[model samples]
Target: MFFSPAQIYPFPGTSLAEDPEDIQKEVLENYAKDLPPIYLDVVQHADLSTLIWAPLMFRYPWNVVFGKLSKQNITVAGDAMHPMTPDLAQGGCSALEDAVILGRHIRTSFVQNGQVLVLKNLSEVLGKYVEEKRWHVTLLIMWSYISGWVQQGGSGRGMKFLRDAIFYKFLFLKMVKYVNYDCGKLDF
Candidate 1:
């Protein structure tokens, strides 16, 4: 499994002395029942005879933000103003859309006076960008989180069936149209 806590867990090149063979065996024995079973023949097990355990272990955290970056100062872009989940993969696309709209607004403001104007002159444009795109990004993040929660829920069976049958097939597909967008020709 992948490392759960970056700081708390041992990483690559860490000494195996920390958790000796007995501890490792006990830990694996406890968790093996919780994990999905796998076949060793799925991959080349030629090296299995030489190694102590499996090489790859994926440990994904629940609802992790991972890292955050300051997205906006005076003028950066959309993601700077909003921080959300990577659920729908709109983090960058929405940023691109924001950049396009903001750039056009700045271009129009500059072109009107033949010179770059003050920050005060651009506040209205910036406000409009934030006002217009905030709700869209918020919805994207909310839905992404909800979907993830459902999929990774506690050994779900009935819920998963309902989600796959009703939401994923009937509802979620249409909601995805918000992310596959291009703002270039818009008159916003």
Candidate 2:
């Protein structure tokens, strides 16, 4: 089974902390106290002067799921296949890439397995899927790690500077590789 929560957002850091007075200062700065009843209701539940802090955690189950659909056995894209830090926003994009790659691999697998696939050929099909997906998926996975590290201030100053100076530009080029996606156009 696969699960994707709707509440996940980009992690600014592992956590945010503020003293009671500072918390009030921020709340006032954000103007949440005047927004509406729906917003103010959350404040009504507790003292506005309390020390409020929210901690962020990146949790990835990284589980694999597969099923056969009319001779097409495959998995759903997303945290089900590869769960990455939300800092990159690529978790979903990575899933899309997985679905594309998997579809391509399955089609090729069927062609190689002949009209009737046997138990022995199952390994061959799955193996090919892994082989084909490894490098491309790995590139995205590494990017996810780098993006998260930089976003959370975990990266060193030099790395952060480099990202600001060069990697940001590099990202646009990378987008081309991702956007020109077509399982059918791929050259095996």
Candidate 3:
């Protein structure tokens, strides 16, 4: 059973004590104050002494716009290419999509060149891979961030209405439709 309480500021490494148990208790106490009754009840009874605390960090989609994903023949895929919030549960799926698309591009290039390994061809192959994945990855990042924001933004009445009534009813199906995306076969 895992629970993630959103929007907590990361604890500075220097402020952490040597004792992990103490840190765990302090973390739970500090963050558990705002949890709803159901979660608070679980926390109260759970043996959280062995609980592990890891920060969830992600770069906003806009920050990645101007960043270069490829340099010469080298490129990145998966989380390295698009680190997003887990709200959409698409991180690993997108990574696999990256792999299939990248592999398909590489296979096409290799086959066209008579299976010869050319340094210059690699540059184009990686560029194509990056170009193809850029928009898709950016959209995933944006949507995942928005989903996380909507689900955990605030507990106020208006926010609750927006989240529960509008988002869940109307937007959730659209958000999850990305799961139907087909990365296509690897065979050229």
Give me the candidate number with maximum lDDT.
3
Displacement of residue 93 (Cα, Å) in model 3 is 1.1
lDDT of 3 by residue, 53-171 (tens): 56656566654577788989999888888888787899899898888998999898888889876788898899989888888888787777778777866678987997899989988
Residue 90 displacement in candidate 1 (angstroms): 1.5
Task: For candidate 3, give the lDDT.
Answer: 0.75
lDDT of 3 at 69: 84
- In model 1, the clashing pairs are 1-57, 2-57, 2-58, 2-59, 71-80, 72-80
Regions of candidate 3 where Cα sits further than 4 Å from its true position? 1-19, 22-52
User: What TM-scores do the predictions have?
Assistant: 0.54, 0.49, 0.73
Can you write out model 2's per-residue Cα lDDT over 1-188, one digit (the tens) per residue? 11124223334333343676666656655658677888666654557565566643444333222222113344335554455555556666666666666657656666676745565556556566655554555455445555555544537787677668766778645744663544343334
Expressed as tens digits, the lDDT of each residue in 28-123 for candidate 1 is 555444554463232322343343443222223222223222123354455544444455666677777787877777677777767666566677
Candidate lDDT (C-alpha), each: 0.52, 0.53, 0.75
Q: What lDDT score is found at residue 95 in candidate 3?
A: 91
